[model samples]
Target: MHNATSRELNVDVAIIGAGPAGLTAGYLLTKAGKSVAIIEKDETYVGGISRTVEHEGYRFDIGGHRFFSKSAAVVDLWNEILPDDFIQRPRMSRIYYEGKFYSYPLRAFEALSNLGILRSTACMASYLWYKAFPIKTVKSFEDWTTNQFGQKLYSIFFKTYTEKVWGMPCDEMSADWAAQRIKGLSLWSAVTDGLKRSLGLNKKPNDGMETKTLLETFRYPRQGPGMMWEAARDKIVATGKGQVIMGYGLEQLAADGEGGWRMSATNKDGDKVVVKAGHAISSAPMRELGARLHPLPETSWNGSNLKYRDFLTVALMVEGEDLFPDNWIYIHDSKVQVGRVQNFRSWSPEMIPDEKMACVGLEYFCFEGDGLWDMADADLVDLATTEMKTLGLLDPAKVKGGAVVRQEKAYPVYDEDYAANVAAMRGELEHKYQTLHLVGRNGMHRYNNQDHAMMTAMLTVENILAGERVYDIWCVNEDAEYHEAGDEGAEKALPAREQVSEDQAAALNSMRDVPERIVEADADETAADRRVA
Candidate 1:
């Protein structure tokens, strides 16, 4: 029924999906005096999964986003964009299993007590046995995790929650995901850290080596991550970038024959907006982007084959002043459909307007159009309430109200052939469309953090401005070039890694050497170039 006359607009760049990556690219390009248009499918919200949802006076995150990054550029950009809204939040999370909460990072005594002496002894024995005779070829997540944390600990701590998140058996999932997410962490390190914690040695390890997951604190927007995105959106528009057109669902994208692109998008009010641009950056899911391209590229098949896991958050507003202190809890209980529970109050006290009430988000990972996804909002809320009550987390009767937000393509699944499929798609896209670039999680079919998504966008803009691939966007992963340069030097310097523990050094020895980053930048010349451009 979208019958309204199509309005056309021309710009230097057209970006699909006004997410973290798209907005970052738009903001930087606009700052550099490039005209840009960003189209977002969501009628509301600027951040994709990172956006904060508000109901009544309560605010919650989709999946909790910790503003922690290894990249100095990303951290600097965040500070520049939203300087005042950030709050230092103490990291607290637990694994809820068998009607007990086990501290994550495994509080030694707590974990030992929970598992009991016999089980603890057995776990240790299993770990030593696995270490002595480790799996030679680690093909699956189960294999890799068992090698690191032992089969016993992997089954107890990692298997259930991971299965719930991916909706797949651990053995069937790709080992790359485990390596990426939980790299540099092992049972030995956790036990040492736990021992230190129990001894009240709460300072960072003297060796200065720690896993990403073991970070003790993180930054979060006082209101939510949406505040940062909203600020970015405002700055982009203020600098004369094209207005961020929300509710614009791209229907088709085609080459306009003049080394440019023509895009047709549908709005909520049954209106179509046609945009023509010299360059295009997309944060849209690879699958959706494939479907929208006329005479689809060879990459479309790979994109179609790439899988995604959807997510939904059921925010249950309860009548309680004080709830659990953890920012979130992983539900390792196989009986419950909810994979995790977020304590919004702990994230930021400002989230809950009333001191008498607390809001918790019950996160369920599901496939789009599945039974859980298809369930009515009320039914989902009831289910969440019942599950929470069953877990003895909270009383079902105390749940006063609820809100549901379903996110599609929430996680790009890492299956057996995902790497090959993504490689094929990337190669084809890079070769076929010189100006068409993909960034962000779903955009690249890479499960990355918001900062990584922003890094991709930042590099993409750099390429667009240079009219060449100046920076390789694919290198922004776990072992990517992470600069520890201070605020002023972040743009220029590439620093060395901090002194590492022996264990960390051993871990690094197994991987290939990190290539030196070579970016020659004459600051004075660049300043002059900015003015000349």
Candidate 2:
């Protein structure tokens, strides 16, 4: 069961998972003249879900990642890692429903015209009825969305795509998610804005007051997002003080008895790797890390209780011109199981090796052992092709080839108990292992973007270097903006827990925004009975 031979390395810090968080920490630690070792489970890629996969000279992103952040430090670090490779690309995304493409912000005339007169009248009537007799208590996504945009519009525009992404019915999802994601916008506002645009009266420059979701352009690496991580990995190795050990996954983490950690990992060949470090930074899923720890903490079960959502991308190579100008389109049609489609050429021309052939990624969200995830690669490709044709976006005859990439734990699940579980686990781990730091999306069980993950790692590195927790890294919000700002590498301390206002403290304690599944009540009762009750 075990290999006799073993390799050992001593480092100031041992990092797990060579994702954005771990790699960022390793790079920063090495740059600070510290010995570091980073271990990644994947043998071929470093960017985790953000990695670009290449097949037959065609490169495609697992899920389209737009490089945009509100944090200056994150943007600076992105530029610092791969300075010359960054390219500015226009951002375009739309929702595809029935047989029409509607602007994401919803242009009034276009949306009305797309829906025939009868359907438009029904939608308006639904909106008026809901407004007149709104649900007294908005508890679930269905309730909140229907209250805002009416039931007809919600079913047409939101239900299918949202359900596909989360793998749950909208009525079973918490309203908090809807409130957070679709904040500052309502049907009335959208109509007003749309009408203004239709009449050429809405000419205003974005002064940072505009909604953050409606981004116009973003920077991306010419090659792919993986290029950024690859560059960081090379730079870390060039430091001569860091080592990135791929194909090795953490098996055990125990105390060294000298106030440090002894991390053991094994590769597919069963070769063991031991890293003795003064500090350990883990970007691994909290559940996996809990299971690997020796003399596990009392609240370790909370970590195990944390859940995750998996994702897979089916990239189809088609023999034709580019399908759409948008980088990606959300498939709101319930007729197909596909959630979204990403166009490689729209992301960057360099991503496609052959200009004549177009590559598009059909993304599906599913559980690890579900039928979709267990589907054969060829079957997945075929399913993608059929769905594309059904959506009128593809021609089956023009399909040349296809490839499928599956990613486990792509999005951390936000269930009813996730917050409490994460809090208990974090409290225990931080108290027991002062030198152990959890960073990144899975590490914290937060659904954060790449920049937010990097910010956590950056703050963790600062804490390690200072030998104390000077920054409350948890204060990094979903917007990738730190609640409190400090100069780069500066040691400005975060305010004490008691010093912040209640609202500020709540913000600090809150996890990044992700939809949570609503727990059902009274399994024995009928739907009508439950509603009446």
Candidate 3:
């Protein structure tokens, strides 16, 4: 059913999106001698949110990606793609609250010193009180965090920043998320480590065994993450068995009535191109995939209900020395709308073309089409400049120029209903379309890091080649644990489909948590209050 105006391609596999997940699949498929056509909507960039944007000789990292993964295969693949570009950089970030900067990972001594003796005493008392009477049935992020680090400390350090990032109250978020994100360290452990460091007794180097949040160093590409994907694209093309088609967006995906997939994509110019493949690997948002399917599956309605959070970055160029040495600073100060600030030079000297000048990116989390997302580029730049001055991190007079970049569907929202919805979609899709494989963050609606995304694609490729579900990709990086030390792909031995018990599979499919909307009653009250005011 191809139109005369449309061009068609035939391949063994078709890959959607050119992100780490999609490109990883395409590269591996082609290397294994399978023909693949990778489609990317963006005309210029390859990496999705991880891309580096360049303007007037300066580069900006969208959200400041760190090249660290617990999976050795992911680490090795990164090295293989961009071998000589990798550089070891010290990890530095801090929490800025009420005009004071505190070390991240909650350094006991520094946090206590910054908080003052009275507040510190209260924090300790609250910690002890919670320790004695911990929440018996922890259900929400607030409950889990309060139990881990006293209510006082949680309010001071965890509440405001987390709310800003997720646009929801901590009480509504799932506790399982906190267990995954802030795992390992606790109030007692932090205090113990702080005292040892202060007394010069903790001289151990970071052997990749430390908590993920406490890692002192990480690797980075000399330019930015985009370099890695671009290289992957080039290698894929060199193979001649693969082609990366840019400026094309998926319009429709349908079964060809012969156990093969026929995908239709359109470019900005409205020109259409089609690819017919035996299998399809998608990294597109689950909601979008559901909508575009022809003869949509039974549970496609569940996919339509999935939600996402969007992000935008405002990069400012300043004429002076770098503002700070840290890679980025978490803005826990509720007064400012900017959530975090990234120092480009700190990421890599090459990211900033000029040594005499500095480029810093201000990150803002917002829903798509919201006020921030709709703001004019010029106004956003001005807003970023003013906020930087207010944070005492920059001087407006020193700013030379600025630019804005918006990324849609930057994060998958994990509301209370998300787990059920994702499960429903997976059940029908896996049963009805065995050749269709979902991978990556938005693909699976999982809030995983780049490594987790890559692992999913890696396992999917294995399943595809074996002509059977040899590995259950959903179980890869199950807890999202960040391990620093391991051989490449050492722990990537994922469970096979037949090997997974029903209970284990259910637990594995449980979606990772993000913020959820408050109850309807609470939402109505808040709206009423706003209207009254």
Alpha carbon lDDT at 329, candidate 1 = 89
What digit string (tens of lDDT, one per residue) describes model 3 on residues 397-486? Answer: 999999999999998887768888889888988988889999999899888778778878988898899998877777753434343333
Assess every candidate by TM-score: 0.82, 0.89, 0.86
Model 2 residue runs over 4 Å out of place are 1-4, 107-109, 188-213, 480-511, 519-533
- Model 1 TM-score on a 0 to 1 scale: 0.82
lDDT of 3 at 187: 63
In model 2, which residue pairs have backbone atoms overlapping below 3 Å? none
lDDT of 1 by residue, 361-412 (tens): 9999999999999999999999999998888889888999999999999888
What is candidate 3's local distance difference test score? 0.82
Candidate 1 ranges with C-alpha deviation above 4 Å: 1-3, 107-110, 118-140, 143-152, 174-214, 478-533
Best by TM-score: 2
What global local distance difference test value does model 1 have?
0.78
**Candidate 1 residue-wise lDDT at 216:** 59
For model 1 the local lDDT of residue 137 reads: 57
